[model samples]
Target: MACENMKRVQKEAINNWRDHLKRKLTGQSVGTKDWLSSIKQQQDFSRDDSIPPLTAPDGSVVTSHRGKAQVLAAHFSSKMTVPDPEREPPTVPVLTKASLGNITITTEEVLQQLQQAPAAGIASWGKRWQVTLAPDKIQAILISRRQDAVNWDQHAILLEGRKIHLQESVNILGVEFDSGLTYTSHVRKVAKDAAWKLSCIRLVAHLLDAQGFGTLYKSQVRYLMEYSPSHGPPAPVIPPPP
Candidate 1:
C-alpha cells in the first residue's frame, strides 16, 4: 500500500512537471509573458556578460570604464596594510662576501611575533616574503566516522582572520570527498556525466562505423566512466559491439 501510494504521488508530480514545461514551451501558451520571460532569461545567460557600472565609496556612480577601474583599485587597496615610509632602510650597500654577517633575528622574537600578530607580522628573514593567502579560494573539510553524529558547526577554522567553516564534502579538481571517505558524490557525478556523453554519442551511432564508434567510446565516454576506476559501483556489463 505504501509503495503504491509513493508511485501514485511520483506519477502525479512528474505529470505536473511535464504540464508546466508544455505550457511554457508548446502551443498557443508559448505566446504568453512567462514564455517570453523565460526566453529573455536564457538570452541573458547566453550573452551579456558585461559588468554593470559600480558605485564608488564616496556616493558617486562610476559609469565610465576608467572610473570603474579606479573604484575597483581603491576597493582592493583598502584590504592591504600600508607600508611605513619611516621604516625604510638607510643602507645602500649591495650584497657581497664582505656584507655577509651572522643572523640578528632571534628564535624567541619569531615565536612571539607569530603568536601575537598572526595576521600581520614580518620580521625580515634572509629575504622579504609576501603573504599570498587570498581572502577567497580557501576550503576545509572535516572527515569522521558515520556513527559519529557529533555536530562541530559551532567551531570554525580561522586563518589570516578569515573564518573557514568545515564541510561534510568538498570538491577539489572535480573529485568530491565526504566525512566517511566513501567518495560517493564524486563517483555518482562521474557516472552521470559519462552516461550523458554516451547517450549523446548513441544519437549518432548509426553514422559511424564500428571502429569509429569504438574510438569515440574509448576517448569520450569510456574515459569518464573509467576515472577513479577502483571506487564505487561497477559499470553494467554491455554486450560486445556486433
Candidate 2:
C-alpha cells in the first residue's frame, strides 16, 4: 500500500510540473517573476535538518549540529585579527618607468615582418582571419632608453636592398609609441585629441541633461581613451563655459 501511495504522489508531481510549464509557455503564468520572488522570500524549499560532516580543528570529525556551529564560529573568529597600532608599515616596491630590451634579431622565419619600404598611408580586420601586408605601408620604430635623440628622418633600415625609413614614432591600433617607450609622445597626442573632442561636446552640453551628456561622453569622447591599448592620464572634463 505504501509503495502504491509513493507512485501516485510522483505521478501527481510530474503532472503538476507539466501543467506549470504549459501555463508558463502560453503566457498564462506569472513567469520568472513568481520564481524570483520565491527565491527572495526563501519559500517553496523543503527544510533540511541535515548538515554535511565537518572536520573539527583538533583533528577529530564533528558530527553534532551545535558542535559544528561552534567549530565554524571559532574558525570565522580566527580570521578577524585586531590591527596593532604600533605595527610597522609594510614595504612596497617603487614605481618606475618600465624598460624594454633592444633585440636586433631578424630570424629567417619572420623575415617578412622586418621588410619595409618608403611607406605612404595605412592601417584593418575580419573573422575570416586573413591579413594583407603591403611592404610600402610598413613603418619601423626603434625603442631605446638613451637620453640623446636620433634624427630619425635621416635614418633608414635596409631590407633586400630596399631603403626602409625609420620613424620617430609609430601609430599602431590608435596607440602611438615613440623610440623612448616612455609613452610621452602618445600622452601628448591623446591630450590634444581629447581637448578638441571635449570642445565639440561642450557646444551641445546645454541641450543634454547630466545623464544624457554622460552617455554621449562615454560613447564618444571617453571610450576614445578607454579602448586604447595603453592609457595615459585622464583628460580633465572641461566644464561648459557660461
Candidate 3:
C-alpha cells in the first residue's frame, strides 16, 4: 500500500511540474525558484565558446586556446588600468577654426596623436600587459552626404605607421553601416534572418501550441527586429495630423 501511495505521489508531482512549466511559458508568473531555474537554463543555452584566436603583434596568429585567453587578458588589463592624474598630459596639436569656419587639424598632427595614444594608455599597465592594435582590422569611413565629392581612394588614415584602408561599409557591433549611413541594408539583413528563424519555428509548430509559439517568437524573432545601435540618439517618431 505504501509503495502504491508513493507511486501515486510521484505521478502527481510530475503533473504539477508540467502544469507549472506550461503556465510559466504562457506568460504567467511563476514561483521564484521556477523563475530562477528558467533564467539559468536560458543562460546555459546562450553560452558560447571562448574568444577565437587573434593575430599577435608580430603578425603571427595565436591559434592555441591558452594563447587566445592570454591575449585577451593582457588587452583588457591594459585597457582597465587607471591612469595617473599627476602625470603630465601628452602634448597634442590643438584644432583651430579654418578660413571656411570648419575646425581642422593637420593630417601629420592627427597621425602623431594616433601613434601616441596606445603608448600613453598602456604606460600604467607596463610592457607585459601591452596590447597591439591590429592595423588590418582598423576601418576608416567618411561620413559625407556627397559620395562623389569624397575621394576615398585618394585618402587614407595611418595608424601605427600602417595605412588604414577605407571601406564603403562596415559592421559596427551587429549592425551594418554604409557610407550613405542608411539603415536599409541592416533592416533588410535582419528581416531575412528573422524570416529564416520564423521558418524554423513553423517547422516545429505542430509540437507547440499558440502560447509556446508566441513565447518563442518574442524571444527569437522580435529581439532581432528591435535591436538598435547605442551610439546615436533614437529616431524621433512623427505623430499623425489631426
Candidate 4:
C-alpha cells in the first residue's frame, strides 16, 4: 500500500501548500515554498508552480497578499527539479494508439522488481487475504472490468489493492445487490469505488509513461490529474480466493 500511503501523504502536503498559498494571498506572510519543503520531500508530487499567481493591484491588502502568493509561486518555480531528461531514457518502448485498444498489454514487468514477498499481516475480519511484501510493494494487480468481454473499458488494476464495496445492501424484489453487481469481472472482488480505481490507474499510467511503456496525451493527463476524491480515501482491500 505504499502508493496509497504516498498519495495520502502527497495529498496532505498539497493541501498544506495550497493553504500556505491561500494564507499568503490573504495578506499573511507564508514562508518560502522551500520553508515548508518538508511536505514536498515527503511525497513524489511535482511542485512546479510555473504560472505565477494572479495578483491584486499594488498597495491593496488583498492585492498584496496575492502578490506574496505570486512571490511564493515564483520561488516554487525556481526550485523546480525533475530527473535530467538527457539522462539515459527508459529502455521500454511506448505503446502507440494501435496498442491502446488492446487489453492484453500491461507494463507489469516494469514493476516486477518492485514486487516483493507477501507480508505477515492478516485481513481485518479474519479474511483469507494477507498483506504481502514491503509497503506499496504491489505496483499492480489485474481486476476485471467486465467478465464476459475483454474490452479496455472493463479491465482495471488494483494498484494498491484497494476495493470499494457498497455498504448498505439494497433489495430489488427477490434479488439482493452485492456491490458492483452490474460491473462484474472475470476476477471478482474489485474495488467498487470509481474514483479510487481511477486514481490508481492514473498513477499507474503516469509511472508507465515515465518509464516509456505508455504515453499520456497532455489533455488527458491534465483532466485525470484534476480528479478529486469526492467520496473518500480509497477503500480497504478485500482478498480474492486463492
TM-score of each: 0.38, 0.38, 0.40, 0.17
TM-score head-to-head 1 vs 4, winner = 1
Using lDDT as the measure, the top candidate is 3
**Could you give candidate 4's per-residue lDDT for residues 32-79 as a string of tens digits?**
453344344444334553333344345433224456676667657757
TM-score of 1: 0.38
Model 1: lDDT to the true structure? 0.61
lDDT of 2 at 43: 35
Error of 1 at 74 (Å): 77
Local distance difference test values of all predictions, in order: 0.61, 0.60, 0.64, 0.40
Tens-place lDDT per residue, model 2, 1-242, is 99999999999987876665444444422224443443433433323424555798679987667888998899888678666868888997868778667876434423334343223222223213455655776678756554365354455456434566767888887677787776788888777777888998999999999977875675556645654454443333333322
Question: In model 2, which runs have C-alpha deviations exceeding 4 angstroms?
Answer: 1-136, 145-156, 230-242
Tell me how many residue pairs clash in candidate 4.
Answer: 11
Candidate 1 local Cα displacement, residue 54, angstroms: 73
**Candidate 1 ranges with C-alpha deviation above 4 Å:** 1-131, 146-150, 172-174, 228-242
- Which 10 consecutive positions of candidate 2 have the poorest summed lDDT? 118-127
lDDT of 1 by residue, 12-103 (tens): 98787666555546532122344555554544432232445688888987666678788989888877857785797788777665755677
> Residue pairs in steric clash, candidate 2?
none
**Clashes per model (N, Cα, C within 3 A):** 0, 0, 0, 11
